[model samples]
Target: MDEAKRVEEGLAGDGQTQLIKEDCQGDLHKKLDRNDGGDRVEDAPEQPMAETAEEQLQVVKQKSKRVATLDAFRGLTIVVMILVDDAGGAYARIDHSPWNGCTLADFVMPFFLFIVGVAIALALKKIPRIKDAIKKIVIRTLKLLFWGILLQGGYSHAPVDLSYGVDMKHIRWCGILQRIALVYFIVALIETLTAKRRPILLEPGHLSIFTAYRWQWMGGFIAFVIYMVTTYALYVPDWSFVAHDQDVPRRYAVKCGMRGHLGPACNAVSYIDRQVWGINHLYSMPVWQRLKACTLSSPNAGPFREDAPTWCLAPFEPEGLLSTISAILSGTIGIHYGHVLIHFKGHSERLKQWVSMGLCLLIIAIILHFTDAIPINKQLYSFSYVCFTAGAAGIVFSAFYIVIDVWGLRMPFLFLEWIGMNAMLVFVMAAQGIFAAFINGWYYKDPQNNLVYWIQKHIFINVWHSERLGTLLYVIFAEIVFWGVVSGVLHKLGIYWKL
Candidate 1:
C-alpha cells in the first residue's frame, strides 16, 4: 500500500488507540514506542506520511542549529562595548570619534542593531505558529523597552517626580531606552504586519508595505536625506531658505519664543520635542546641548552645573539622534540581507564574497567622499559615516557567516557565546552602576575610583609599570572577568534574554 494508505490502515486497525495514545504520551514516548505488542503490527513497520513529514521537520530543525559564527561576532561586539565603556582612562586613548569623523568605537551600536535585525529574521523562521510569533515579538519588544528605560533611570539617580511645574525637568526625555523602543517598535511592526514573510522575495499580500529590500533601501535613503536636509537647513541656512547661523540653541530659543526663555540653553530639538510631544515625553532635550555638557565647556560644566536646577536639562546630542537613524537602517539592511540569504540559499558563498568586496570598495569610496564634502563624523552620523561603518559591518558579518555556518567551525571560546547570548543584559549591567560599583568597592582603593584607574595603578603601574602592554592586558582581563560572571550566570540558568 501507499504511504498514506498505510498510515490510514495503521490508524484504523490499531486496537492501540489507548495503547498508542499511552505509548506516545508525555516525555516518555521514545521508551514507550520501544515496548513490544504496543502499537506495532506484525508486518514491516508502517511509515506514515505525517510521521515522515514530522521526521523531516525535526531534521531541518537540527540542521539549523544556532549559528556559532554570528554568536561569536556578537560576543566580540559585546566584549568591545564593555571594554570601551568601562575604560577608566582618557577619552582620546579609547578610540572615540573626532568632531566629524568615525572611530573604532563607532561600530559598536550599529553592529548591535544589525545583529538584532538578523536575529529577528531567524526568530520568525523558528516560530511555526503565527499567533505565537506575534505574541513572542510583542513580549520581547516590551521587555527591551522596559529594560532600556530602567537603564536610563540609572542616570537620573532619583525618584520620578510627577508634580506640577516642570516636574518633567528632572526626567530625561531621550535616552538609550527611547532609542531601543523606537527601533524595536518599527522592526516588530514591520515583521508582524507583513506576517513575517520575506518582503523582497515573497509575493505581495494585503499587508505588504513594499518588498523588504525596497523598504530597507527606502529607509536608508530617507534617513540620509533627512539628516542632510535638516542639518543643512538648520545650521547652514545659506544652502536653504532657512536663516543662516541659526545655531541649535538660538534656533531653539526662537521657536520656543516666550517658553524658550523659561528654559536654560537647551538645544532647539528639545524645544521642538516639548512642543510636539509634550515636555514629559523623552527626547525633549536638544542633542548638541547634551554633548557639550558631557564633553567640553558649557555654562553648566564643573561643580556649579553638577548641582544646578537645570543640570538634567542637557541637550540630546547629534550623535544620539543620528544614531537612531543609523540603527533603524542597520536593522532594515540586515532584514533585507537575511531575506536574500533565505531565498537564494545555494549562492550564499558567491553572494557573501560579492557583498564583502563591494562593501570594501564602498568604504574606499566613502573615505574619498569624506576627504572633500562630507567629513566622517560619528556625532552627525554623516552619510559618509553610514557608508563607511555599514560597509565595514557587512564585511565582518560576511566573514562570520562563511566561517561559522559554511565551514562549520565550532567556537573555541564557549564563554564568548555565553556573553553574546545575553548581550543587552550584560551591557545594561555594566552601563548602569552594577559592575562599576562592585569593582570599585572590591578592587579599587576608593569606592569612587574608576576601574581603569585601579588597573593602571595596581596592575599596570605596580606590577608592570614600564609597559603599555600590561595596561592592555589588565583591561582585557577585567572585561573577561566581568563578562564571565554575567554570562556564566545566564548560561547556568538557561536564560536567554531576547528582545
Candidate 2:
C-alpha cells in the first residue's frame, strides 16, 4: 500500500512498538468479516480483501516500528540550542552560567550527549561484525570532528562581520561538536567492546540491564575517578596570560599555587585546557567573563571591571579535554536508558526503569549541589551537572515517548520530529550562525542593512518597543519557528543531513 495507508495500519496496531501482532492478525480479520450482530457475513467480498489487508498491515507496521520519541527529544534539544544561542543575550538567566551554577543553556550539551547515548544503544543493538562497527564508528567520529572544526573553528565571521577567515595560530581547537565527536567515539567504542554477539536481551535476568553493560559502567567510573583525582590532586602553579585591552595586549599574572580549587581562576579544567590547547587556541569569549568579578553588571559582557581578577580576562575552554572526560559519564548514563529501551518490550517496564533511574540521579545531584561537595558547574562538566542534566534528559525523553509514541499523538510534534531527524543540518545553519552569515553577506547600504538586522529592528524591536523582549520574540519566530518549518519541508522532501 501507500505511505499514508501504511501509517494508518501501523497506528491501528500496537501503540508502543507501532507493530502489528502477527498472531492477532487472524483474529482481527475474523472480526472484520463478522457483522455488528456477531453473525458472519455469508457473502463476503471474494477478492480476499481480509487477507490482502492483513498482509498490507503487517508490511506497514514493520516499516513504521522505529521509535519516534528519540527524534522528538533530539529536536527539542536543537530548538533549545537555537533559542539560547540566538536570544541568550536578552535573558541572562537562560544564558550559560558564569562560574558554578546551572542555567537553561547549561543543560543543552549534556542533553545532546545523553540522547547520543540513547541513539547508540538503539543503533548498536545488533552489530554483526566488530570490524565493521569499528570502521563505522571511526568514520562517523571523523566526519563529526571535520564538521565541528570547520563550523566552529573560527572560519565564519557570522552576524558581526561579512568577512570569513581566521588565523590558524589563534583558532579555537575545541567546541560542542568536537566534544560530541569525542564522546561518541569513546562511548561507541566501549559499547562495541562490551557488546555480545547475540542480543543482551536474550540473557535471562531482572538485572540483565546492569549486568550486561557492567563493563561500560566500570569504564565510565574509571574515567570519572581519573577526572576526580586529577581535578582535586593535580597541582596548579601560578600562571600568567595576556589580556587584551582595546587593541593593546597586557600580560596578567594569576596566582594559583594550590590544588583542588574549583574557582574560575585555578580550576584543573582550565589548567589542562590551557596546557594542551594553548591559551591562545582556547575559546576567546568564554562564559566566565560574564561573572560579577569580570562584569560590573553581572551576566552581561562589557568592559572589564577595574578590579576584575586576572583569570577573568584569560581565555578558557568550556569543552576542554578533562571536562570532556567527566562528560563521558553523561553518555554512560544515557547508554543505560537506551539499553532499557532495547531490552524491555513493555511500555510500563521501560517507564519503570527510566523513571527510577532518572529520580535516583536527580536526588544524588541535588544532594551534591546542596552539600557543596560538587556544585553544578557546566564548564567543568561536574559530576552533579552530569547527574542533573542526564536525569532531566531521561525524564524528558520518557515524556516525549509517552505523548508521541505511546499515545500516538504524533501530529503536534511532527515538526519537532522533522527537525530532530535533520538536527545536524539545522544546527549548522541556524545555531552555528552559517545561515545568518550567508544572508548577512548580501546586505544593502553598508554591512548594517541586512535581512537579519532589518527583521530584528523593524519587525521585532520596533513593534515590541523593548530590546530584550523583542530579541526574544525575534529568536522564537525568525530563528526557531522558521527553522522548524524549513526542517518540516525538508522532511517532506526526504532530505536529511546525517553523519
- Give the best candidate by TM-score: 2
Structural similarity to truth (TM-score) of each candidate: 0.65, 0.87
lDDT scores for all predictions? 0.48, 0.77
Q: Please identify model 2 stretches exceeding 4 Å from their true place.
A: 1-64, 197-199, 202-206
Q: What tens-digit string does per-residue lDDT give for candidate 1 at 1-499?
A: 1111111100011011222233333223242111122112112243332344345333222223344544566677777766665452323345444344555667776666666665555434323345755665566556655665555633433112211233444444445555655665566456655554444244545223234445555655676666555444433111101212236532222222232121233333333444444444443333223234333543122232453333234333432554466567666655554444444434463355338543864666476565666666555455566566666766777776666556766555466666665665566555454554444544345544655555667776578755455655655676666676667687777655444
Task: Provide the global lDDT of candidate 1 against the true structure.
Answer: 0.48
- C-alpha RMSD by candidate, in order: 12.3, 7.7
Instruction: Give the poorly placed runs of model 1, Cα more than 4 Å off.
Output: 1-60, 125-138, 154-168, 196-212, 234-323, 347-361, 364-368, 431-433, 438-457, 466-471, 485-493
RMSD of 2: 7.7
